[model samples]
Target: MPRSFLAVSLIALALAGCVTKPRPPSHLGATVTVAPPSKADVWQRVASAADAARIARIGSAWSEGLAEARSRGFGDEVKKEALLLRSGAALARPAPTPGSYSCRMVEIGSTPKKKVAFERFKPFFCYVEVEGELLTIVKQTGSQRPAGRLWEDDVASRLVYLGSLALGEEDQPKAYGEDPARDMAGVVERVAPFVWRLVIPYPRNGAKLDVFELTPVTEQPK
Candidate 1:
């Protein structure tokens, strides 16, 4: 071989040896010491496309749910809970005191396929606790419990909620993205003194709005 050709081949080999393979974004498919996705990151993967859309357009839930209720002749019922049901009723300092709470579920609105425009379940027990940089809410008494963290958002008066349902006697529920059917998303706000509501729009159960009102349980002297 010519000296020049030999030199060129050596240079090519050296360049090839220096090349490196790119790293995957998620460290995907690498099982050993795999880094689990953060709770904040699973919202997109776990929530259904339609549900995500509903969360994105949460502003419409008030008008739409109320409209559905009024259309079905539930206006008076809605008017009765005016403060808690208002769309922009969130107050400043939206954080809730960490303690047990009395929670209730109110479902409003329906598609033509179903006739349930408004339904309110009896009060149940829930608990709020501090979790790292977020606050967590867990339904303490119910066949279907909701548990999730409250994330601070750009909005001033509300915190975004990303959670999943815990069924039966499960100790720890699957993470949000682990099950699409279990994933739940909503916004938490303080609508009245010592009162907050978690409003979920376009709930999978066919309701346009599913509001959970939470009020702290007063501590009594032992």
Candidate 2:
């Protein structure tokens, strides 16, 4: 072979080796240690892969579970995070004490109409109690801004999502704040108690679940 030809062949062989070099197990299939998806990722994936109805079902269950968990006095950050993921929102209000009241709700879509309920802790100004599927803590500050537009928007979005899933092509655009048709806004009247209710069978089952109360309980004795 000619010297120049031999040199070119050697260079080509070297280049081929470089191109075919083995990768680390972490970079290769099977052996790769892929990081588990985050909570947000799971939510997005559920929303994306599953049909809208399935997503709505899961969202409802998830919301219901959150209310139950939080009511049971689970103070871990994950509990709060789970609630937030289920379209839960809290408005800061000053309690009679130094603490604050957080009102949360879940918007559930069912046949005939959509149901909205307080998860627990409506008159959160006086209760430091956490029960099964409910939590009410008294805040020192008496009058803080109620969870105004923020809570309303959160609930509205939940309704919109559920509506879209249930109604399919008839899904309507969301209207936040005072608008009735767009927002389906519900008032937090003292007569009603908590802001969220555990209405409708969860997991879309035939049977109904517990009706959680958001009423504030008397301060627990230390």
Best by TM-score: 1
Residue 209 error, candidate 1, Å? 0.4
Which tens-of-lDDT digit does each residue in 1-222 have in candidate 2? 899999999999989888866687864555547897653343343232332344336446545654644444543533443423333342333111212234333332222232322233243332233334322232222232111111111232222111111122333333223232222212121223233222222423221122222443345323
Candidate lDDT (C-alpha), each: 0.85, 0.32
Question: What TM-score would each prediction reach against the true structure?
Answer: 0.76, 0.21
What's the lDDT for residue 35 in model 1?
79
Give one digit per residue, the lDDT tens place, for model 1 in 90-177: 9999988898888998999887888789888998888899988779999887689999988766676877788899999898777876
Using lDDT as the measure, the top candidate is 1
Q: Name the regions of candidate 2 deviating beyond 4 angstroms.
A: 1-33, 40-196, 199-211, 219-222
Point out where model 1 deviates above 4 Å. 1-52, 219-222
